[model samples]
Target: MWLEQMLAAAGRSGAFYEGKRRAGQYFLRYELPRTEAQFALLESLDRTTLDMPADCI
Candidate 1:
């Protein structure tokens, strides 16, 4: 599974961060595009636009 591979890679690469969780959950969620158009729109955005303000995470 892609999620499993991603987690494994993160663990091996020391990229994993600890986060709060509820019960047995990992407290992480994935948001997938509902349609191809949404995906295309997201893909069209320039990477620079994704940078956050220095004060904001």
Candidate 2:
């Protein structure tokens, strides 16, 4: 699944770690669904970009 892939990528980059540190929650919210654009963004995201937070990256 795409979410699984995203989570794995986040794990590798430490973005998930940072998010957990700040939010006391998972790196991503479960309720808000991803759009097609968001999936495209994920596909296009490279290593350096993946190091940033999910909101603006």
Candidate 3:
């Protein structure tokens, strides 16, 4: 969202150019892959807090 806002501020709305493209490439190559691993870890969890309440802590 911040990136989109920055692009819009620069009149590049909904378009990824140069640095934006590089940022997206970096995310896809690095950060995006972490999501699958994180999700796998979460999926392996035993639902320990499925019914937990927000204020419980």
TM-score of every candidate: 0.24, 0.22, 0.47
Give the range where candidate 3 is weakest over 10 consecutive residues by summed lDDT. Answer: 5-14
Per-residue error for 21 in candidate 1, Å, reads 35
Clash pairs, candidate 1, are none
**Whose TM-score is greatest here?**
3
Mind giving the per-residue lDDT tens digits that candidate 1 earns over 1-57?
Answer: 444544545534332422212211332343333456777878888575568677775
For model 3, residues 1-57, the per-residue Cα lDDT tens digits are 535634545645454455675675677688877899879978898676776887896
Residue 9's lDDT within candidate 1 is 53
For each candidate in the order shown, give its overall lDDT on alpha carbons: 0.46, 0.54, 0.66
Q: What TM-score does model 1 achieve against the real structure?
A: 0.24
Error of 3 at 18 (Å): 0.4
Give the Å shift of residue 17 in candidate 2.
40
Q: Specify the poorest-scoring 10-residue window by lDDT in model 2.
A: 22-31
Model 1 per-residue lDDT at 39: 78
